[model samples]
Target chain A: AQSVTQLDSQVPVFEEAPVELRCNYSSSVSVYLFWYVQYPNQGLQLLLKYLSGSTLVESINGFEAEFNKSQTSFHLRKPSVHISDTAEYFCAVTRGGADGLTFGKGTHLIIQP
Target chain B: NAGVTQTPKFRILKIGQSMTLQCTQDMNHNYMYWYRQDPGMGLKLIYYSVGAGITDKGEVPNGYNVSRSTTEDFPLRLELAAPSQTSVYFCASSYLESTGELFFGEGSRLTVL
Candidate 1:
């Protein structure tokens, strides 16, 4: 069984400020990690993913996450955020052959103007 | 691009009532999944299908049933609605396994009273 833990339930940051959402996972086997973002009244969209190779993965929108195997963490970070970045972010994990991803409790990113 | 589509964007069901949430994908992906999202609880997988005619249970499949009759359609049925089942349901698909990115539907919000 695999599990994901997102320590922050909510994170508030002013416009142009940097933000980091912490995520950690526990799995007996090698796992793939992903970050998904959901805007108000919309479905989730893939932000980025860490499947293999380089430890750092980035999304087109300027968000990036690093896969740290030693620490079992994949934390999302953005140097600066905008009002449009306010949304619920979820961290998920899956073993390569699993049926579905195991998601974290989610972290609501609240960006202030 | 009409990616994944989920019907009944919002529905209200009385206790003991039954309803089916429809999902369709135009991407021709071999893997489809159903997940429910609760506030502060992220998303929990209910069921998944590897391809047409093959289905399996996920983390939370007790109160729900699913059928994948074709590559494009995977419908989830709630036999007897309950307040505990009040949440937003999302349908997603991926060409490969979790190693690939997932495309999601806009989601269907269901409320049971």
Candidate 2:
């Protein structure tokens, strides 16, 4: 079984400041990686994903993650964050042929103005 | 189109009570999933369906049951609720075109008293 671990439980940053959320995974085979964000009282929104191809995947909202196969990690980073970017983030992974992703404990991103 | 939908946005139940979380998708997706989100914990898969008739247990499915009778409906049943089961639940669907991008519903908040 594949598992994901998010090192940080909470992250607080000033608006417009850069931020990075660390994620590591445990899997012996090929896998897919994903990052998802959940705003307060809302469902999850996909931030980015790395399935195949270039290891660095970008999202529309200025978020990006680099899949480091050597380290078995996919960390989400943003050069600058907004107040609206404050939310809970989750890192997930799935094996090559599996249909579901295994998720890590979330990291709460709090943007302070 | 309504991507994914879950009903009873909020519910409170006594221990040992029973309830069913309703879910539906209108995007004609072949894959549907049920997930539970605990505070500070990322979403955990409870159940999943490959199509209308094939349902399977996920990472955390011991206390839950699910059925997929139609392409659009997948209901999660909690036969005997517990405080440990209190969490926000989400329903999601995705196309096979991608293994990591899923469309999620707003979510259902369940509390066990």
Candidate 3:
């Protein structure tokens, strides 16, 4: 069985400050990684994904996550955050041939203005 | 296109009541999924369908039932609502299962009293 772990339950950062949300996964087979963001009262949106090729995947909204196979980690990062960036972020994993994804307990990124 | 759409954005039910959450995708995606989000729990897959008439249980499917009669519709049914089932329900769809990005609906918030 595959499982995901988000190390931080909450990440508080000041506006314009760098932020990182840690995630780790355990899977017996090769997996694809993804980062999803959810705003208040909304559904989750795909922030970024690591399917193949580049280990570092980026979203258009200045968010990026690196997939480190050796460490079983795919941490999301942003150079600077805005008040609008305050949301819940989730890390998910799906192994080869799987039909569904396994998600971690999300990290609430609170951007302090 | 309305990538994914879920009806009844919010609902309140008494214990032992039954209801169905309707989901539809106009993108003609072959894969559809149901997930529930709770505080700090990110999202847990409740059920998934690879295509019409092909449904499977996901990580958390104990109290839910689903049917995929058509490619565009996948509805989740709760036999007997419970307080534990009070959460935000999300419906998503993707073109493929192996490595496809998911498009999600806004979500349905359900409160069981």
Cα lDDT, all candidates: 0.93, 0.90, 0.90
- Candidates 2 and 3: which is better by DockQ? 2
Q: Score the docking of each candidate (DockQ).
A: 0.74, 0.72, 0.69
Position B101, candidate 3: lDDT: 71
Per-prediction tally of clashes: 0, 0, 0
Q: Which candidate is the best by DockQ?
A: 1
List, residue by residue over B24-71, the lDDT tens digit for candidate 3.
999888889999988877888999998999999998999999999999
* DockQ for candidate 3: 0.69
TM-score, every prediction = 0.97, 0.96, 0.96
Tens digit of per-residue lDDT, candidate 3, span A1-113: 88999999999999999999999999998988999888988888889999989899899989999999999999999999999999989898887343677889999999888
Residue A9 alpha-carbon offset, candidate 1, angstroms: 0.5
**Candidate 1: what lDDT?**
0.93
Instruction: Tell me how candidate 2 scores on lDDT.
Output: 0.90
Docking class of predicted structure 3:
medium
Error of 1 at A89 (Å): 0.7
Candidate number of the best TM-score: 1
Comparison by lDDT, 1 against 2, better one: 1
